[model samples]
Structures are given as structure tokens and as C-alpha cells.
Target chain A: MAVAESPPSDPEAPPKVRVGRTPGRLGNRVFQGISTASGIFILIILAAVAIFLLVRAWPALIAAPSAFEDVGFMLGRDLWSWVWPLLFGTAISSVIALVVAVPLSIGIGLFISHYAPRRLAQGLGYLIDLLAAIPSVIFGLWGIQWLQPLVSPLFTWLSTNGATAWLEENVGPTIFTGYQAPARNILTAGLVLAIMILPIITATVREVFLQTPRLHEEASLALGATRWEMIRQAVLPFGRSGVISATMLGLGRALGETMAVLMVLSPGYLINFYLLQPGQHQSIAANIASHFPEASGLGVDALIASGLILFIMTFGVNLIARWIISRRAEFSGAN
Target chain B: MSKRIDVNDLNVYYGDFLAVEGIDMVIEARSVTALIGPSGCGKSTFLRTLNRMHEVIPKAYVTGKAVMDGQDLYGPGVDPVEVRRQVGMVFQRPNPFPTMSIADNVLAGVRLNNRRISKSDAADLVERSLTGANLWNEVKDRLNLPGSSLSGGQQQRLCIARAIAVEPQVLLMDEPCSALDPISTLAIEELISELKNDYTIVIVTHNMQQAARVSDRTGFFNIAGTGKPGHLIEMDDTTTMFSTPSEKSTEDYISGRFG
Candidate 1:
């Protein structure tokens, strides 16, 4: 065999060769550095959005110096009073959706992961993925055109039969059999939002349920526990933290949910006691989307300011969720 | 305190492929039976079949009878869950429920079966089980600690305590000491010997010395060739199996000539 090749060198000069050879390990270090750069890129995008929202909404911020002056506080009492009503409407409708959606979301998640067979579960899971992919505007159109008619009577039943007893006394309206239906009400809009956010919550929770360690299930079942008992003792305990995280994620989605709330809520300008009574019940997101096009100078700023609030609310929720899961990393990492 | 098992002409399969073939064996009451085999030999599969734990896999199954305490364990109406309850299992690596404390781990079986007891009774059961597994003295002061906090030996012993807490008639151990250090392995072997006084113990072990040290009887499993199903080669008293004559195949296996 030929001796290992080397470049021809001058015999008179001392041989000079490569120093500090990296032992072929530098390639792995380079690959790791490349991945770190991509990870940092994601962080950069998030920081940029936060900073941009802050800058754009600075003029209309609640804490802005210009937000002061009893002049505006008095005005807040008067015509410019759309803020509280909208805030109230947003809070009320989102709360309504939370009540209806959170449990249903978790139930759907568990059923898909545990109760359904492989093909049916996969098909259903794919349908949920499809729902998440649909835009909020398309959801809005579908809600108004298709869903409302189907849901209106159920709303009527809930409003009348042993339902809304609180509504009668609280709203200063006397009880009547079939008086008036706030068909385009917060109740209507909330139901729409619930349907929209269901897929999000279900996806998060299903991922969590599926991520539960297989050893845990085997260990539980080997104890001679019935399936339900195993789920309750082993699956549920391990899943509690994941459920909370999923709920937070769903809550954030609901708080910022827009077009469906806009198209269905029958926008109002008053923060009334009767949610179904249909006064000026406009959610913050709905309010902005509806009015931002019409607002002039500071009004546009004010809407951006409201957008800022929405952005912050959503951001804060996500931040708290990330913080929580870091402390208790129990949620399915894929979610 | 012991219960017998009759695994008759059992064939284990995953989906369509056979894993073990024609395993006919009877495990005596209150005695230790060791299954020794080479890699890919189906000793672990046979051990899992005893407790019906093979059902966990989607298509894994047994085609013959495994009668526990004279009840046809694979009868049409026999519940696998109930079989597992009566015949408990300890896996290769100690698997105490991570969410539970040491005491809770021991009580897990009873709790899962919804067998209620007073708090005082539960504490007594915990102490008794730990003492039974020779783990009480090491763990008595810290039963509230997470089950995973114990050293490997203590964890395996805690698992033994957990398995015995249900008062199982049979315990199926699948290479239970394979993941342990020599010291832990020794501890487990000693525990198995004492354990056999109450529970019928079937252990699948790669270590022939361990099989010799702990078992009353030994069954040697060997494969025919690559991708061929495993079958029992020989079964006899551990002493004769180790010291005296047997089939050429059995002698070859015991003598480490071939497996």
C-alpha cells in the first residue's frame, strides 16, 4: 500500500501542518449551533410582536397620561361609555362560553383518546383538526347562516322553561310565557364562540390524555382495577395539571375570539343586566372589528388601544400558562 | 398460602407470528419456578401469560389454558383483570406508581379494586407488606416519600411489597432483577426464596446462577432457529438439572454449550 498522502513540502523548511484539529466533532457542534439559531428566531418573533403591539397601542392605553382628566372621566359616564358595556359584554359572553365549552372540550378529548376505537378516534380527531384550521370569519358566516336557526329554539327553551328565572327578577322584566327572544344575544354569540373554541380545547386536552405514560395505565390495570377506576386514580390524577393548562389555552382563545362574536352578538351599547334582553351587548373584539373601520384619529387609536388590551390579555394568559407548565411540566409537550 | 398454575400446550403469538410454542408446564403451590433461557427465548412471554398481562398488547395472545387454583384462567368467561388480581406481576425494572408515595404504592392494588379499609388498617397493611418484603426497616420512617425516592434495591422491595399487599396467590416476575446492580440482585434473590413460602413464584431470568440460587424447579426454554418460536427444552429439580444428566439439549443449555 502507498504511504498516506501528504502535500509536497520543501525539504529545507520545517514541516508545517494543520494545528488544533477538531477531531470531526466540530460538525456536531455546528449542527447544534444551527438549531440554537432557529430556536432563537422563534423567541425573536414573539418579542417583536409584543413590542409592536405596545408601540401601536401606546396612545390609547388605559394607563396613558392622556387617559386622565375628570373631563374624560365625566365623559366616561356619558356618551363615550361604550367601553364598559363592551367590556361587560365581552366578560359575560366569554364566561358563558367558558361554562359551556370547558367541560365539553375535556369530555370530547377524553372520549376520543380513551373511549373511541382507533379508526373512529382518528377520523374524529381529523375533523377537529379541520375545525381548528377553519378561519374565524368562515366560522362567523357558518354560525349566522346555519348554526343560529338550529340553536335558537334551544335558547328559547332555556330562556323560558324553568330557565331564566333569575332573568325575570334580575332584568326588571315581568315573567311572561313567550315574550321576546334576544335571538341575536350574548347567549347566541357565546354558544357560537363555544363551538369555535371547542376544537382548540379538545385538541390540547386530547394530546394531554394521549401523552399519559403507558406504564401508568398498565400498572393501574394490573391492580385489578376496573377501567374507570384506573382512569380515575391513575389517568385523572396525572391529567389534572394538563386539564388546567388546556383550559387556560382555551380561555385565551375565547377571550380573543372575534368574528363569530361580531356577526352573531346583535351589538349593543349598554352593559345591561339581562344578557338575553339584548341591549348594547358588544364584546371588546366584536366592538373593535365593527367600529375600527369607522373611527377617526384618536378613535382609531382607542380601538388599537382596545386591541392592545386584547393582545395583552391573550399574551398574559399564554405567559402565565407557559410559566405554570414550566413549574409543573405535566401537559403533553406536543400540545 | 400458595396456588397452582397449569399452563397447557400454550402458544403465544403477536398478531400472526408465533412467539412461543407448545409450553406445557405446571407450577406447584408455594414454590419457586425459574425459567432460564437465551435472548429471544420466550421465558418472559410465558411469565406474562401466567398473569394474563399479555393482553396489554393489541394482538398478543395465548391459545391454551392457564388454570390458576383450578379455575380455568383462560375460560370463556374468566376476566383477565381478575386473573391479574389473583396473580400479580413485577416487571424487569421496578415500577412503583410515580404519582404515589411509598405507602400509597403498596395500597394501590387494594384501592384500585375498591376494597375499602379504615386508615388504621391501611397503615397496618402497609407496615405488614413492607415487613413481608424485608423493606419495612429501610422504608418505615419515610413511607410518605415518593415511591421513586428509594434506592433501586428498596424500590424493587417496595414493588414486591406492593404486589404482596393484595395477597396474591401467584407472583409473576419477568427478569425482575435484570435492571438491578449485583447487590440489589442478591437482595431480590433472597427475597424471592422467602416469598415462595406464601406465593407461587415464577421468575424468568437470564442469569443461570440466579435460577439456581432461588428456584425449587427450573424450566429451560430455547429457540429452534432464527425467527422460530421458542419452546421448553427441559424441566426438572434444580439440583439434578444442575448436577446430573438430562436431555442432550438440556445438558448443552445448562452446561452453556448452546442455548
Candidate 2:
């Protein structure tokens, strides 16, 4: 082997090598500062919104029944009495939407991620994402114009044939019973909300399902698990916390939805179990959106107070979702 | 309880492309058969074909025959699921079901099949399988912990325990210790040596020394070049293959010449 020649200047002295610093140091600092500012900006906006709502709603929050006498619907009702019904409506409608949507989304999500042909899966995924892009107001229009008339006969049949009467007789008339025609009821609003939120939940679920580690899936298959068994063993468990957070995302939308509930439901002011009956319930967002325009003085404050409640409900739900997700992480295989 | 495998003129394909061609070999029962090769030479693909796991990839298929005992694994009406039940596989990476506890992962093959086992039987199976895999002492107390909690080597052994919990006749390992540290590699190699007494084992490895240490018989697979189908170059007792390979290319490969 031939020896390489060395530089003549470094024969008797230590070599001097330039230690160059990383390039674009200022750009990196600016980028980090911008990202950190953007993150803090979200907190600032959230806090500002909360403060504004509380300031506007404070008067109505302390108002007596006489102060709300000018409020057309549910007149002379105190803040708690009036807000409780709206809160009940919000919770029930969102619950109903989730009950109907979660399983369907899981099925569709699994189909697109695992069962469908590759080409078809791509198309179905695109279609579901497109559904999410549709405006909520259009969903409201479709709910009232198309879905309401379509379900009227079925509602009429159930009411007339005593199909749901047994629920009243047995379980003391929980929200599951009391069918009515015209289909402009809380249940109809809920079904429409279910349809509206289905795409959001399904999209999240599909992405999570698609992200199931290929190695884990192959391991399950190598262990002799059938397609369904593999899904139960690998796919579902991997996506459990993901699905809960996805459902919560859907619930957040359903809880805060205004146009769909306002347009589909005949708003009422009492907490009741007659989900299939019109004029039986009203969610907070729909209540405010409907009355905010005509509301005057303290009535405007009351609507803002209701909006504050909706804000808190959404916040509470997200907190609960994070809690569940963190709890699941303790046992999750992903760690 | 273990089974020997007979492969006759097996050709593996991915879509229209032939990945491996003209493979003929017999794997004996109750022994470890190691397939050694360079990267992308189809040794791993051949390992997957043993359990019909190759078909899990879209458009991947195999032609010709792979038989275990008296049964044709690729015959019509032979469910791949059933084939997999009898011939379990471990990947190059450790992959225990993430959502499952150590005990549940050990029972996954059986429970995933929807077979019913009593609490006592399940406990017994977990203990026996873990003990067999040489992982019992480390994880016996944390059987309820998520399987991912184990170290890389222990996770690989947990995967081994999971594969054997179903009591498969054959266990195919594809570079089972490739991702592990030196100590973990030794642990898995020792486990493989002991496991061959009860189960027919086929392993694919890049490590020639590992093949020499743990395998009774060794087969060399090689590709002519890129886009060419990989073929089985030669097979012999591990001692003979490592010392004096019959094929020039096998000797060149073993002697650290160009792959």
C-alpha cells in the first residue's frame, strides 16, 4: 500500500481546522419563535373568548324570572330553570347522535382501511372526506326537506302500532320511545346530527385503522387469526383510544351544532323523554341561534350565557376524551 | 408433535414478477433448518411461504407445492388460516399485540381463533409457553403488563411464547434476533436450539455464524442479480456447508467475497 502525502505546514505543529457553526442559525431561531408564538396564540384566543362570554353573560346569569319575561319562548323562567332544559337537550341529542354514529363509522372505517379493494378503498375514503366538507346548513336543509318526510310514515307507524309504548310501560318512558309523525323532532334532529358527524368520526377512524402497524397485523395473521379475528385482536385494540377521541370529536360538533338542530327541531323548554315528539327539547346552540336575533337587552345576555354553557360543555368533553385516551395509553401496546 | 416440510419446485411471485424460483428442499421434523442469504434474496419470502403468510401481501403468490406431513398446504379447500394455525411464524422484528397483556399475548393465537379455554388452562398455557421460550423468569410476575413493556430481546421471546402457545407443529423464524443486541441474540439462539427438540423450525438469517451455531442443516439462497429470481443455491449439514460448501458462490459468500 502506498502512503499518502501530508501537508508541509503541519509537520511540526498541531493542525488548525476551522469549526464552522451550523448554517441558517437565525432562520432556525425565527422558525422556533414563530411556532411557539402560534401555539400560545391559540391559548390567548381561547381565554379571550371565555372572558368575553363571561362578561356578556354575567347579567343574565344572575337575572330573575321577571328579567326574562320579555323572552318569547319559555317566558318568566329563571336562568337555571331555562338553561337546564337546553343543557338536557344538548346532552341527549349528542348522546343519540353518538349512539347511532359510532358503530357505523367503525364498520365503514374498517371496511375502507382493510376490507375494500385498494382502488375502491381510495374512492370510498375520498367520498367520506367530501362528506365532511359539506356545509352544516345544507345538512339542515336536507334533514328537513328530504329526511323528515321520508321518516314520517315510519314514525307514524311506530306511534300508532304501540311499538314504542312498551318502553313507557317498562322503563318509564326514557328517550327511546314516544314516536310521532312530521319527523321534525329531537330524534330527527339527532339522526341528522348523526349523519353530519359520521364523516368526521369515520375519517379519523379510517386514518387510525390505516396506520395500524403492518408488523402487528402480520403477526396476528401468522398466528392463524381470520380477518375478523385479526381485526378484533390487532386493529380494534390498536385503534380503541383513537376511536374514543374520534367519537369525542364528533360529539363536539354535535353539541355545538346550530343550524341542523334549529331547523329540524321544534324547539321546547322542558326536559322530557319524548324524543320522537316535536316541541319537546331544544339544545343550547339552537336556542341561542333562534332567539338571538329577536332577543333584546337581558335576553341577549341570556343567549350569550347559554353560549358560555355550550363552550364549557365542549371543553369538558375534550378533557374527558384526553383523560380516557391517557388512561388507555397506560395499557396500550403502542408504548 | 412436530412436522417436517417438503417443498417441490416452489416459485414465489409478487404480482407478475417472479421473486423466487425453483426451490426444492426437505425440512426434517424436530430440527432447526436455517436459510442463509444476502438481502432481498427471497429467504424471508420462502420462510413466509411455509405458513402461507406470503399471501398476506397484496398480489403475492406461490406456485407448486409445500407439504407438511401428509397435507398439501396450498391445496384447494385448505384454509390459509388453518395452515397458519399449524405453522406459526415470527418476524425479524418483535411484534407482540400492543393492547394485550403478556399473558393475553401468549394466549392470542388460541383466543384469536375463538377457541374456549378455562382460566386454569390458559394460566397453564401461558406459564408453559413462557417457560419454553426462556422468558418465564423475567416476565412471570408482570404477565398482566402490556407486552410492549419488555426489552427488545424479551419482546422477541414473548413473541416466541405467543407463537408456541397455540402449539403449532412448525415454527418459522425470519431473522428472529436480527433486531436484538448481542446478548439477546445469544438468548434467542439458545432458545431456538432447545425449541427444535419439540418443534420443527425453519429460520432465515443474514448471519452465517448464527446458522452454524443453531441450525442442524443450512440452505443457501442467492439471486443472480437485480430483477432476477432468487433460487436455492445449495443445502447441506451446517458443519459441511460452513466448512466446505459445495457451490463456489456459497463459498465466496461465506468467505466474505462480493455478495
TM-scores for chain B, listed for all candidates: 0.97, 0.99
What's the fnat for candidate 2, on a 0 to 1 scale?
Answer: 0.95
List model 1 lDDT by residue over B1-259, tens digit each: 6799888999999999899999999899999999998889888887888888888787898898888777888899888888888988888877777667889999999887567899999999999999999999998898887787788788888888989999989998988898899999898898998998888999999889998999999998989888899999889989988888477887887789975
Best by TM-score: 2
- Give the range of the ten consecutive residues with the poorest summed lDDT in model 1 chain A: A70-79
Give the winner by lDDT.
2
Task: Give a tens-digit lDDT track for model 2, residues B172-219.
Answer: 999999899999999999999999999999999888899999999999
Docking class of 2: high
Instruction: Judge candidate 2 against the unseen true structure and give its global Cα lDDT, from 0 to 1.
Output: 0.91
DockQ of 2: 0.84
